[model samples]
Target: MNLFELVEQLFEQYGYLVLLIGLPLDFIALPIPPGNSTLTYTGFLTYKGIVEMVPAFGSAFIGAAIGLTITYILGYKLGMPLIERYGKWLFIKPSLVEKTQVYYNKYGNKLLIICFFIPGVRQFIGCFIGMIRVPYRTVWIYGYTGVAAWVISFFSIGYIFGEQWQYILNVVEHYLKVIFICLACSFLILLVWNRVKREKAKKLSNATRNE
Candidate 1:
């Protein structure tokens, strides 16, 4: 069966436990159900009264935290050796890790919050953070909150849309591409604007000195 069908079967049989277990596994990059679709489906169930809302949300949040924590710890304990040995399989190069570390260092833990929203990014971010030795407290504060917000948002969409919840998956997938494009354009604009400002300032300074 397809992933959504499999997820539906699991949830129908196991309910909250499935979410509690499944979410973390997905976060850890397991080839299980997609986390977003699962969470949204749970929310739809909650609206139908098949599952309680609080427990569903709580289970998802906890599952995500547990999964991320495990990955982070693994990254911390194993360090570069693990990456060097198996990173190629995951397509993670040492150069990419170095670049991620540099960006994380410059931007601080806020990137951890933003990473959760990016598909294919959330899976690796925890490991990278842990490998870089970010404080556990910082990870808990930023990482957990981000996961919580992400879970709640998607779940809420499912709950609000009720029987139409399936549409959310398509909407999310489409919007994500649009959001990424917008972000890229914004970043480029800011970079060019900053360069132009600096050049203007330098030219003005030179003119003053010459006068």
Candidate 2:
């Protein structure tokens, strides 16, 4: 099944169990939107009295922490060695991981906390933080902080609007579309600006060298 159907099925079949499991699994690099749809559904169910909000939010938070810890362990055990041994075979981009490490080194622990809200990279931030050798304590503090933020923000919003779960879902889908379009436009603009700047820089450098 496609992603939308799969998520809907998850909501229908597993509900709280899926949120508990999925939140962690997302941290492990599963391509699931655990941060958004899962939390939204969980909130809806909590309001429906099918699941208690505390258990739902707390379990999800714990699961996310465990998942991130496991990711760090796996990265520590295999991430570097795998790169050294076979990353070339896997179409891996070494610079992305390297840059991520550099950011951790320069910024300290804040980057980890910030990445949790970013849709795609949040999963990898855990692994990258470990591969970059940020202290485990720092990683946990930053990662868990993100989990707490997501759990509290989404779950609380859901609980408060339980009466309008379906309406909220519709609004969310609409917003997702808006978010995607805005991101696309932003990326295109950035790309164009970078290209123009690169060309200008190259001309200036060449002129300086000629003199």
Model 2: per-residue Cα lDDT over 1-211, one tens digit each: 9754576577577766776678877877784765666677677677777677677887878877777788888787778777767878886666655754664577647655655656666677666766767787776677788778867766765677876765776675576567656755865686588679999999999999999
Evaluated with lDDT, which candidate comes out highest?
1
Q: How does each model score on TM-score?
A: 0.76, 0.67
lDDT of each: 0.81, 0.71
Which segments of model 1 are wrong by more than 4 Å?
1-5, 84-99, 181-211
What tens-digit string does per-residue lDDT give for candidate 1 at 40-156?
888888888877888889989988888889889988888688778998999988776786576567775776786777677778777778887888999989999889888988899
Clash counts for all predictions: 0, 0
Q: Against the correct fold, how does model 2 do in TM-score?
A: 0.67
